[model samples]
Target: MANLFLIVLAHVTVTAVVMLLWLARTYMKLKGELQVLKNSVQKNDQYLAGLSSSARAADSRLAFIDEQLKGLSAKLSAFQQNEQSANPYNAIIQKIRHGASVEELMRDCSLCRDEAVLLMRLHGSGPG
Candidate 1:
């Protein structure tokens, strides 16, 4: 009976030691996986930060372009108004549309020969 009791005690001790070793190995593997996850999260955070900065820069550039477009629109509006007020070719256009000759446009509208010909091509009654 004493030998039976000793044999049972030795078996229990060996089983407990094996279970503890398995627990240790599992803990080590889980800790290594946690560390890898942490590193990946850090890299993702850095990449997101860079993207955020780039987005900010792009927003600034877009704002600058918007301002430039507004300025160009205003300039175009002013130029269009000036062109409406200062048009010098209305009479020449009318004469060309009425089938006036290039020589007549040059003589009456004080246009050069090339200017008369170009006007005829653009606004004349006949094909040019």
Candidate 2:
């Protein structure tokens, strides 16, 4: 009866040791996996930071381009206004194209004689 009791005790002890070894192995594997996950998280953080910096730079460039476009739009408006004010005799030129005489251009456009003759020479169908 004493020998049977000793055999049972030894079996339990061996089983306990085997279970501890398995537990230790599992803990080591989980620790390795956790380290890999930490490295991946750090890489992702660095990539995100770079993207943030690039986005800020792009935003500044876009703002500058917007300001330039506004300036160009203002200049285009001023140029259109100047062109409208400068060519008040477009109707008289069209009339001259239809063979209107210099005297007719002077009468219709209220221009001086020299201005009418110049328009006739420039836009008329034939020589002034």
Candidate 3:
């Protein structure tokens, strides 16, 4: 009877030891998985931070480019106005306003007589 009791005790002890080893292994696996998750989250956060910085820098550069384009556009607009003022037709029209004759306009601006006559009529003070 004592031997049978000892045998049952030994069986329970072995079963308990097996259950403890299985629980410890499960705990270690869960801890390893948690560490991996933590590392992944950390890496993602760093990547997001870098992206945010890059986006800010890109936005700043785009704003600078936009300002440069505006300045260039202003310069281009002024140059176009200056070019319009420099047109020979504008000078010829002024001369017509000051009462230059059709014959003089035709000679100075290389206009046909018909064109010169039109300009003289449009801009000249009176028929001549």
> Which 10 successive residues of model 3 have the least lDDT summed?
119-128
User: 1-128, model 3: which lDDT tens digit per residue?
Assistant: 99999999999999999999999999999999999999999999999999999999999999999999999999999998897778857888888887788888888889898888887777787545
Worst 10 residues of 2 by lDDT: 119-128
Q: Which regions of candidate 3 are displaced past 4 Å?
A: 1-10, 88-113, 116-128
- Model 1, 1-128: lDDT tens per residue? 99999999999999999999999999999999999999999999999999999999999999999999999999999988887678867767877877889888888888888888888988885533
**Model 2 TM-score on a 0 to 1 scale:** 0.67
Candidate 2 segments exceeding 4 Å error: 90-128
The TM-score, computed over Cα atoms with residue i paired to residue i, of candidate 3 is 0.60
Model 2 lDDT tens row, 27-53: 999999999999999999999999999
The numbered model that scores best in TM-score is 1
**What is the alpha-carbon lDDT of model 2 when measured against the actual structure?**
0.88
Pairs in clash, predicted candidate 2? none
Candidate 1: C-alpha lDDT: 0.89
lDDT of 2 at 29: 100
Q: Using alpha carbons, what is the TM-score of model 1?
A: 0.68
For model 1, give the 10-residue run with minimal summed lDDT.
119-128
